[model samples]
Target: MHTDPDFSSRGRRLLCGTLAASVLPASLAPAAASAAAGNWPQKPLRLIVGFPPGSSPDMLARAVAEPLGQALGQPVIVDNKVGAAGSIGVASVARATDGYTIGLTGNGPLTTAKALTPSTPYDVARDLRPISLVATSPFVLAGSMAMPAADLRGFLEFAKAQGDKLSYGSIGPGSGSHLAMELLKTHTGIRAVHVPFPGFPQVATALMGKQIDLSFMIPSIAVPQAKNGRLRLYGVSTAAAFPGSGDVPPIQSALDRQRFDVASWNAVFGPASLPAPVAERLSQEIARILQTSEVKQRLLEQGWLAAGSAPGVLAHKIAEDTAMWGGVIRLTGARAE
Candidate 1:
C-alpha cells in the first residue's frame, strides 16, 4: 500500500515470480493474425512487472494479462524482475526491441526515479512509450490519533505553531509520499522536520506510536488505521473528494487559494518503438477492460479507482508528473542515497 507499490523490490530476496497464463479461447486462431493480421505477438507475449508477486504493479499485471492476451490473441505471461527500486525490471523492458514485451509499473520507476537517480540506466521519455493508465488512488494526509488536530485546517495551524518541532515520515527520500509532503509545504508556506522510514508499514507504526506528527499515505493502508481510531485522516491529495474515502475533503479545500493533486497510478508501457497500431489497439482494449463491472469492482475493493486513457493521454500524465515531481525533488533537495 505504499505510494510506489513496486517498493517491495527494495531490501527483499529476488525471486523470479510468474503468473500462469490462462488458456487461449478455443475459437481464437493460433495465428497472430487472428486478432488483426499484425506481425506482432506471434507467440506468447511477456508482460514484465518490476515488482515481485503480490505487489501493486504485479497485481495490475496479473489482472490485465489474461484479458489483454485474449484481446491480442496471445497468452500474456507475467515475469517479475525485481531490484533497484524497480529500475532493473523497467530497464529491461526499455531494452527489449520486440513488441512482445511490455511493462506494468507505477510512479517509482517511471516518474520519480529519474529526478531521484539521474544516472538511472534508461531514460523514460527516450526509451519507453506510454500505453494506457490502469488505475489510480489519492494519498491521504494522516495524523496520529493522539494529536489534537481534528481536520486539515487544524493540522495546518498545528504544524505552523510547531514550526521546527513538527516532524513527518515517508517511505524514503524522493518517494511520492515524501515529494507530496514537500509540495504541500511549498504551497502552504510551512516547514516540518522529515523522518524517512523504510516503507509505509513502518511509517504507519511510527505515527500510531506517536513517534511522528504526520505523513502522506495511500488510502488502503491509512483507512484501516483511521477506522480503528489509531489515525486521524485530514485531507486527500486530489481535486475533489475521492470515492470510498470517508468524507475527507480535498487538500485544496483547506488552502482555499491553492490547489494540489497527486496520485499513485499504474500504467502500461512498452519500448519507444512499439508500433502505433499495437499501442492504439492495446489502449482501446485496456479501456474496455476497465469499463467492465467485474474489473472495476475488484479494483475499487482494493482501494483503487479504475481509469483508462489514450496513449497520448497517459504520455501527457507521465510528462506532467515527471516535471512536477522534479520540482519537488529540487525544492526538498532530495536525491537517491
Candidate 2:
C-alpha cells in the first residue's frame, strides 16, 4: 500500500497544530484544534472497523458505538473495511487527522500485520494514537468430536500420532488465533497442516462439520457448542479459566506443561496527532461506560472482560505484543497470503 502525499502533509500539520495548542491559553487552544475541545464532535462520528460485520471486533464496536455517541452528543457510525488481515481499515484511520474518524481494532492489524508484511502502510506507534483498551477474551483449544481426544494430554498424543495428517483451522495468518496455535506447536513439537478461514464463525463451522480436526476458538463460540456436544474442548489457552466456561481448567493442568497465555484484545485508536484533550475525554468516558453494571454484564455474558484501561496501558500493550508476535511469525514462518 502506498502512502498518500496529501495525508502526509495533513499529518504534519495536525502534529504541529497540536504542539502549538499546548502553549496556548485555554481560551485560545480550542481555536487551534481541528476538532475544537468545546465542539469537537460537531458532526456524526465514524468508527471504522477492520473485520466484517458480526465478527468479534465488529460486535465489540457496535456494543460501544451507541453509548460512546451518547456521551459525545453525536451519532457513531460503523464503517467496515475488510481486507489484508484488517490492515486496510487500520490504514484508513491512520491517515485521517480529524478526531471524528477513529478506529476499533484488535492486535492482529495493530501489532502483527506489519511484521508479517513489511509493506503494510501504517505504523501503529507512529500513525495511530491509543485512546483506551476496550475489552479482552481468551481462546479455547477445541477438537472435533471425531478426534476422540477426551483431554488435552490425549489430544496432544493424538496429534503426535496423526503427525502431518492432522489439520487445524485459524481465522487467518497473523491473527491471534493463528499465532496461539503455532505457539502450541512450538512447545509440543507437534506438526499439522493449517487451514485459513475468514473469521471465527467459519472456523467454528468447519470444526463442527469435521472439515478440520482442531482449532483455537473464542469462548463465545466454543462454550455453547461444547455444552451441546457439537465440539470437544481440550483446554483453554489462557493461564486462568475463562469466564463462563464451567469446570474447564487451564491447558497446563491437562498436560502438566507450562501454560500459554495469549489473549485477544480490542482497543480504540485515533490519528497519532489527535489532541490531548480529545483523547483524554474519550478515554475517561469509555472507562466510565465500561464500569456500568449493564455494560459489564453484557460483555461478561458474551465471554469478554471489560477492560477500560488508560491510553498508556494500550500503548505499552501494543509495543509488547508487536515484539512477542514478531518472534512467533519468525518461528512459524508465516507471511501474508
Candidate 3:
C-alpha cells in the first residue's frame, strides 16, 4: 500500500509530480474556455475507461464525470471497455469518430503496453489526441508477512535465493505494475515467477492471502492497506517519497543501480481527429473541475493527486513516456502475457 506517485513527462517537471503544479502558470496554456459547446459536444459525452470498475482509471473518470457534465451542460457517461491490459478500451476511444467520445487511461496502454505487444490496438501518437492528465500515483513494491524479508535489501537477497520458487503479481501483462517488477528482476537478477491479475484488488488479495509473494501495487489499492498495516511495503518505484509518509525508499538505492522510476497516471484523450478548439475547451474545463475542493479531496482520499493539465502537457508526457518505457521494455525484455 502507498500514497503518491512520480508522474513522467512535462507534468513531472512543471507540476513537481504534484497536482499543486496546476497553480503554476502554464504560459503555454490557451485562454480558459467560457463554454464547452459551440459546434462541439452536440450531445452527451461518453468517457471511456479501459479498466474495470473500481480501478484507478475508472475512479478518476467517475470522479469528474458529474461535475464535468454540469460544466458542459451535458451528461458525461462513463463507458468501461475492459481487457488486453487496457488497450481494448483505449482503442475504443481512439476509434470513435464522434468528438463526444474521450477516454481516461493510464501509462501501460498509452505507451509501454503497446511496446510490449506490437499488436496493441491503438497507436497513442497516431490514433489519440490529448486532453488532460487526471492523476498520477507511484507504485509500491509490497511483500507478504510470510516472506522472510522486512526491508527491500533483505527481500532481494531472499528472492535471489528462492528463484522461480517465488512469484510476483501484476494487474496485467503490460501494465506499469508489471514493468516495475520486471525492471526489478533485471536489477537484482531475481528469478521470481510472474502472475497476472485482472486489477489491483485481486493483486492485493493475492499478496495478502499469501497466494503470491510480492506485487507492485497502485496507490488506490496499496495506500489504505499500507496505512492499516495489512501489508508490508519494501520499496517504491521512484526516488521521490510519498507526501506525509516516509520510510519507503526508491528501488534504486537498494540495488546500487543508476536509476529506477515507475508510476501510473490517468489522463483524458479523444480520437486523433478531435479539433484543437474542442480539445482546449475540454482541457480547461477538466482542469477546472480537478481543482475544485470537493473533487480534489475525493481524489486525495484515493491516494491520487488530481492534475488537470493542458492538452499539450499530456501530449508531452505521452511522447516522453513512450520513449522512456520503450527503452526499459527493450532492456528488460518485458512482454504481454
Candidate 4:
C-alpha cells in the first residue's frame, strides 16, 4: 500500500488551479490557456469509456454526448475501450494529446484500481486533469431473500454470527463494490469470504439464486427486483436516499455509524496537457447540461444523481477517495489477483 509522497501536493495543485480559474477576472481567464483549443473542437470529439456499451458509465457518456454536442456545436462520439477495471479507457484519455479527447469514468479506474493494482498505465494525479464530476450513486448493499437480516443493522449482526461462513460478491477484485464491502467490515467487525463476479448482472443473478449471501450491487441491477421479491435490499452505502431505492435508509443511519459513506461516482477528465480554457469550457458546458431537467431525469432513470460541479470539485473528490480506498485496501489486505 505504498503512496506517492507528492500525491497530496499534486492534488492541491489540481484543486487550486480550478479555484483560480473560477475566480480569475472574466477577461483574463483564458490568457494563459493553450491555443490548441482556440475556436477548437472543429471536428467531432471522442469520449473514451473503459466499460462496455450498455454499462452505466457508457450510457452516461452517451447521455451527455448528445446535449454536450449541441452546446459545443460539434458532435461528441463515445469510444468504448474496455479492460483492467476501467483503467484502459482512462489511460486512453490521459494519453490523448489532440485536446479533443476526454473520458467519462467511474471510481474503479480513477481511484480504487490504482490502489489495488499500482502499475496502471497512467497516474491519475499526474496524467489526467479532471473536468467535471458528473454524478454519484451509492452502492446498494443487498442480500438474498432467504437471509435472516431484514435491514443493514440486522445484517451486520447476522454477518458477525456467521463469520466467514457467509459470503459476499463484488463485480471484480479492485472495484468500488469490493472496497465498499471491505470498508464496512472495518467499521462493523464482520467477516465474510469475498467472491468476485464479472459485473452487477452476475451478482444480481447470484443473489436471486441464493448462490451468495450478500453483495454490494448497483441500483440499475438491484432496485427493480423488489417487485419480484427475489432478493432483499438492505440499505444504501451513502447517507442519502437513492432515487428509486424506496425507504432504504443509509447504512450509516441504520446503526448510528461513523464512516460508512462509501459510494461509486462518475466524472469527466481530459489529458493533463489540455488547455485550462478548454477544460473550463467543457466543465461549464457539462454543468449546464446536467442542470437541465431533461438531463437530470435521464440520469435519475439510470440510477444516478446528476452532480455537475467545477473541475476542482472532481479533483478534490478523486484525491479524497483514493486515500480513503487505499486505507480500506490496506486494512483488508486486498491485493490484486
Best by lDDT: 4
Alpha-carbon runs more than 4 Å astray in model 3: 1-41, 153-165, 209-211, 227-229, 244-247, 252-257, 331-333
lDDT of 4 by residue, 230-310 (tens): 889989998777867888888988556485787888999987766667888999999999999998899888899998887
| Candidate 1 wrongly placed segments (more than 4 Å) | 1-39
What's every prediction's RMSD, in angstroms? 8.9, 6.3, 7.8, 4.1
**Candidate lDDT values, in order:** 0.79, 0.80, 0.75, 0.81
Ordered list by lDDT, greatest first: 4, 2, 1, 3
TM-score of 1: 0.88
Q: Give model 1's clash tally.
A: 0
Tens-digit lDDT track of model 2 for 32-63: 38574576778898999998998778988888
Clashing pairs in 3: 1-222, 2-222, 2-223, 5-138
Cand. 4 TM to true fold? 0.90
RMSD of 3: 7.8
Q: What is the lDDT of candidate 3?
A: 0.75
lDDT of predicted model 4:
0.81
List TM-score per model, in order. 0.88, 0.84, 0.78, 0.90
Sliding window of 10 residues with minimal summed lDDT for model 3: 27-36
- Candidate 2: residue 201 Cα off by (Å): 3.8
